[model samples]
Target: MTHPAAPARRRFLISALSACAVGGLTTSLTACATSTFPFIPDYYTFSQKQVQEAVQRKFPYQRTVSQVFEVALMHPVVGLLPDTNRVSVRLDARLASPFLQQPVNGVFTLSSQLEYDPQSRSVVLRAPNVENVSVDGDAQAYTQQINAAAAVLATQLLTNYPVYTFKPDQLQFAGVTYEPGTITVLTNGIRVQIVEK
Candidate 1:
């Protein structure tokens, strides 16, 4: 005769098998869902156009040089330097002074390295250097003065200027505090990696 516990053992085995089958189905469904929806990283990217717009907000900047000439900087065009991990801005400049018969139109290009400022929770441009300056019409008379003024503007005005500011919510994720760490310049944009604090 079969053992008394034989039927009970068979019932337990069948129940365990049924539970395993359900668990397997659930695991398979989860795997498929994960495959379809990839995980996102903790990083932020700003396109060239977005950066350009951010830089443009500061303009048109005006400065008086030597209590004489007035320099107006406007229409900023931003470009990314991936190799150096820097940003370049070209601005349309207009110079007006009593010494000159008419206002002079010119352009100045400046490049700067970016740094994160914890106090302000923002990415700022630092140590901006005016790469070049050129004027239209017969403005050669003031080239030297114009170059000097451009240098001053790059330092006094653009330096330490915030390119992007992090919102309070952006720095916090999943109950953990994160801050911007490595900033990389890409061909078409800028990438900021966030790290736990």
Candidate 2:
């Protein structure tokens, strides 16, 4: 009968040989060794010009969104300012109410930081700040009262808004997946670094 310990000895020898081969890595041997394992680190840069173009396309001249007390928001101009590390939106808004027969014109400006959410696999806007506000005449008093509320509203509108959302199929390109990192804001654009799983 075959020795019972022989099989165990053989297996141990085989494992030892394999480990030796891997640890001692010959150039030819390593070159032939295949790894289908996917994932690599990479950088994807998106330019400010691209963002501006997209914003223009998305809003294109003027768009009205949300209304309160018969006052409506309109005429938006979006901007990506690297100096501020934020994306800004300037709008020409008019407040109209039963109390006021004429529409009150004012400017509203908001800015938001850009960030990458690895869990969500997208670049999104966060914590919008109402940086500036200007209302002429009597509208100034009314706007002052609602400034906090308006900022909150704007923040809500911008919160979690995707600056760039990647699809799964797109992530598969060259074994690249969503990378977990901070957004680098530059004068021309923002760069996001990605890595393999």
Best-performing candidate as measured by TM-score: 1
Candidate 2 residue-wise lDDT, 1-197, digit = tens? 76999899788767755764676543222233334322232466777666555444434222222434443566667677778778887866666654455777777788889887766778887888898888766666666554764576576566777777666763555544445465777777777665555
lDDT of 1 by residue, 1-197 (tens): 76999899788766755665666652322222233232223577778887787899999999898777799999999999999899999999998988788998998999999888999998889999989999987677878987888898899988889888889877875577888989999998888877788
Worst 10 residues of 2 by lDDT: 26-35
Cα-based lDDT for every prediction: 0.82, 0.64
Model 2 gets an lDDT of 0.64
Where model 1 places Cα greater than 4 Å from the true spot, the runs are: 1-40
TM-score, prediction 1 = 0.75
